[model samples]
Target: MGCRQSKQKSKDSLAGAKKTGSIGNGGAAEAEFSVISAASKTCEKLGVSSKQIFGLRQSWKGIKRNMEDTGVEMFLRLFKSNSELKNMFHEFKDLTSEDDLRANEALENHATLVMTTLDDAITHIDNYDYVSEVLRKTGASHVRFEGFKSDNFLNIRDPFLEAVKITLGDRYTDNMESIYKVAITFILQTMVEGMEDALKNKAT
Candidate 1:
């Protein structure tokens, strides 16, 4: 008798599961819907719509083709405006010339790493949980570097946009520029949050 009751309960559970799965689909069992993203919500608040997301991914394809050069350009722009930041990187900090900076293996590798992180963030733009965790970890990792401050992430803002503008050349328009601004701001903000999280965890 107990065995029969157990079998009946299992059947009921399967039936209930089927019913719950069909709740919002007009009684059709097709589970077609949108994936929710915390990151998307934050982006929306920052004026990045689905349309802009599509544009970012599209434009990024061009950037990815020349990742190394673009990454180097970004860092070059950064070093240009904030010359003092170069001291943080011992590998190429002593080099004052643009040609030397571009030729340095260390700077190239660092630029590649930064660009790769940006690529990941853009790739997973809709997935808030993933992007935030990645960015936060990135910030946390900087804790070990001497003179590294969370605000340093903010410094990427202008240089990054300029780098993109240079890379895109004729493709870069006023509207696209606006979208890129929103995208980078969102990326840097999360990174700062991650840095702060890391600092707190370290203290504890």
Candidate 2:
């Protein structure tokens, strides 16, 4: 009697799953997965083609880089474009401090860190399910900073591209820009998602 009851319950669960079109039993993987990333969903909604993602990935692999140098160049470009933007880094830090910044040991370390994170993110782009959590964590952490704004991500895009252009020189092209833009867009969207969630949790 006991064995018969257990078998009947299993059959019912499978039958219900088929009716709903889900194949597995309830669990965390499915739950986490069911929570579609803002980045992935936005890509679809914005009609960002798969070609963009693929093109971006392929082009970057061929591009050369002195990661630290490129990172430094990017920040330099960033500060130059909007010197006033540096004040956000402190309660009232002056533009001179931001402008005077150079590619020193600390900057080199930071540059390497940025390059490694992006390298890893790009490497795992094909399997977003694996990378989303880490990106989300990054987004949440950014929110904890003393003074940060979402626009900072958008604002950095131009500088980042400029850095790439300087690094790649003749190798840089419109297609490559498009690729970088796509990758950066995805990253920013994911980060915003995580940050928003973090904020929401704090509010509650």
Candidate 3:
């Protein structure tokens, strides 16, 4: 009787497992379909084809560097207009005066973390839900981590976007609404290419 009960329980457990697996797969399929549908809608809105979006191969590292440089450039621009802000920046810079090497090391470490976080986020595009959740969480967490309010994420994005506009000049801003659409195209292309390469290597 004990053995029979154990066998029956095993069979039930297996059935439950199968059902859970099926549900998980269905959910993933739905998510994938939603992503594709959203991409299509975006392309239509931008008056561009999907092929245009997914055709370019871009370097993730280069994008992150471009973004960071843009931020630094914007900071400098803002500093020029605000003496108080310039003083604050100088004060921050002065803290490292005692040991130039140590200051350099600290700057390098911070840069590494920033780039790593951005790259990891980008590389996980195959899991869109996860990527979205992480971005939201990261944005919120940055406030506490950086000793700023949670709303700074939204505030900060505008400045960076503006910096991009300034840096790219008229070429990037010609089609105002489609700027983001074209940016997403490059991002998705890079992500898909990376994922494909990863899968091919794994299969080999």
Candidate 4:
């Protein structure tokens, strides 16, 4: 019964996705559909649809446009949940204390930047190559950080998801989760791949 219900929910979300969006059309939609269709097929190994990623992107845009300080809240949750990890960040390293978020302009700005980057990428989610390239650069940039690992990204991704859940309130759906899981997984994988490539290049 639960399985059936989940499938039905997916069906509803995909159906609603078509109606909920007014942003893409003509060649844009076709292009996105092509890219998403291929990615979704690849994601079948992971049990998610590309359409779900599209729905996730749409739902996020809705929440973000209407919410205030969500990104800020997200970073707070991130730091709170992963206190040890926070120390790795330059902004939080000199905190004088583990809990000193006050007057942390860099933390605030960096958090906002991360959230805004996500927003920008979701807007062009179909631009997979471009998105992957940018994320790769982001991962490559982290090479200089001591003890940083690809898995550490979950410390960032999970809190961001929680913040989105909170902001969406009752509007959040399982469908979005399904889609977001795929998108997030793919993103982290690409970033890690980039990091690995950077390490290899530097070693050579």
Candidate 5:
């Protein structure tokens, strides 16, 4: 009887492990499908057509490239004329922290907050103040800095929104206009704040 019970317990443990693994894989698959669906919906709303959206990844690639280019240009304008900003930018670009493991974890946390808030911003179009607060907290957490000023935010906001508008086109109009704006704002804020932390760490 004891031997039989031991065998049964081992079997149950193995089954539980397999079930957990399956659940994890399914969760990951669902997340990927959700992202794909969101993209398809955006394209459809923009008049891209369902077939085109799925068939050509190039359009999405182009959008990302354009956004990056726009971001680079805006980054240059924000830091180019100012010596301090330029130095800070260089420091950030060349950062190699002593505590790399912690830094990596911090970055992951920062990314999660930013992405989550941006998604929330898209969903909650009416609550601009709440969305803004999320963005602010995300930025602060990323940089580990106090007192992130409004001007610092505005420097990146215009170009970021322009990039989104250009990329999304009619989709921005179809979904609540504020969603795209808040999403872009949250993204740029996160990027800038993360860079700020990297720069500060490098400087120290």
Candidate 6:
């Protein structure tokens, strides 16, 4: 019964994806369909469609061009939203001013690491299982940090999305925004799962 329900949900989600594809016509429509059809064959995990995957990879190109700025902006926004999160990083704990945070090399390096990790996930978007495992390991590694929590992983969603939006600039269309949301949600959820499992194992 549960399996049947899950399958039904997948169908519903896929059907819903078609509604967003109603943006362009003529050559653009043909091009969009071609990309979506190819992606459909390649990615069908975690309710993520081919269209979303295509959009994700394409939008990431913009982010990749300005990785440092985008990453730093993400962290900056994240820190602003939750100042105490900075305490999780020994290097950032002492920095309180926004100017100082931006200038700090350690913060920039850490930001790069975070952005690069997302790039790694995008690189293996088609292999959901492998990406999940890699993210799990990443989460597990964070267990070493005294104040780290699974929720912290989830917290990255908004700031990350904001950074991507800023980086994409004019290319950040509504459809692309939806795709990024789905991609980031998948990533954060998988990371949280991995962290929770690790934390449980550590308690044993």
Candidate 4, residue 68: Cα displacement in angstroms equals 7.1
Instruction: Report the error of model 5 at residue 157, Å.
Output: 1.0
The number of the candidate with the highest lDDT is 1
- Give residue 111's error in model 2 in angstroms: 2.8
Clashes of each: 0, 0, 0, 0, 0, 0
Error of 2 at 56 (Å): 2.8
What are the per-residue Cα lDDT tens digits for candidate 5 across 1-204? 111122333454446656777436465445444444444444443444433323233223444444434344434444433324334332353434434422444433433443344445444322334444555555555454444443465465565455455655665453434444544555566556655655566589
Instruction: Evaluate all candidate structures by whole-model CA lDDT and list the values in order.
Output: 0.78, 0.63, 0.43, 0.65, 0.44, 0.76
**Residues 61-132 of candidate 3: C-alpha lDDT, one tens digit per residue:** 334556555545444444334324334333344442424423454444543454455456544333344554
Candidate 1: segments with Cα more than 4 A from true spot: 1-43
Give per-model TM-scores.
Answer: 0.80, 0.65, 0.41, 0.68, 0.33, 0.77
Q: Write the per-residue lDDT of candidate 1 for residues 105-196, one digit (tens) a residue.
A: 99999999999999998776755667778888898888898788999999999999988888899888887888888879988988898888
Residue-level lDDT for 161 in candidate 3 = 46
Candidate 2 local Cα displacement, residue 34, angstroms: 16
Estimate the TM-score for candidate 4. 0.68
User: How high a TM-score does candidate 5 get?
Assistant: 0.33
Model 6 weakest lDDT span, ten residues long = 1-10
Ranking by TM-score: 1, 6, 4, 2, 3, 5
Alpha-carbon deviation at 144 in model 1, angstroms: 1.2
Model 4 C-alpha lDDT per residue in residues 43-130, reported as the tens digit of each score: 3544645556556656887656744466766777777777777777775665754346645778767767777667765654545666
Flag the better candidate by TM-score, 5 or 6.
6
